[model samples]
Target: MAIQLVTDQLSNVLDDTLRSQLVGNFKEIEKALNDLDGAQARLNSDQDKINQDLKNIKDGNEIRDVNVQAIVNILTKYDVPIQIVNGKVVDTTKEGE
Candidate 1:
């Protein structure tokens, strides 16, 4: 069996001082719910900002990909073989060829 506080049992408690304390408990519960609602609103706002920032990051990545493709296209137009060694771009074109 579970212990539960039914409304009829609460009404049977005839002490005026004890009844006043119960009213205060309801007020505290209401305040807590209000605080939770406010926090949820702030979380929702932050989530929207985070979503927009993620979209911006995705857009930046696409722009970077397009730029890299353009550079590749331009580089392919030339016949000079290029090499990257030790974090440096080196022209590997032979003088005789």
Candidate 2:
């Protein structure tokens, strides 16, 4: 009878130890998951900002092209020869001619 009581106590202690270890491991896993989620959020935010910046750059380029075309038209109207070379406008009218 005494041995049976001792075995029961040992079994209960082992069960408690296993439960505690499992709880600790779960807590660690939860923390790691939370950290990963935070990192992903930050990455998403950065990507959005980069996309917006690219759009802004495209819009600015379009505006610049419209302005350049207007200038070219005005120059043509005045009989001032101009050429666009490598995205730059160059006046081709000779000063002496």
Best by lDDT: 2
Candidate 2 lDDT tens digits, 12-67: 55587667666666777777779889999999999999999999999999999989
Off by over 4 Å in 1: 1-12, 80-97
TM-score, candidate number 1: 0.64
Per-residue lDDT, model 2, residue 41, is: 100
Per-residue lDDT tens digits for candidate 1, residues 1-97, read 2223334445555788568667766777777779889999999999999999999999999898677656655675675476445644566777997
Clashes of 2: 0
Q: Number of the top candidate by TM-score? A: 2
Model 1, position 90: C-alpha lDDT score:
62
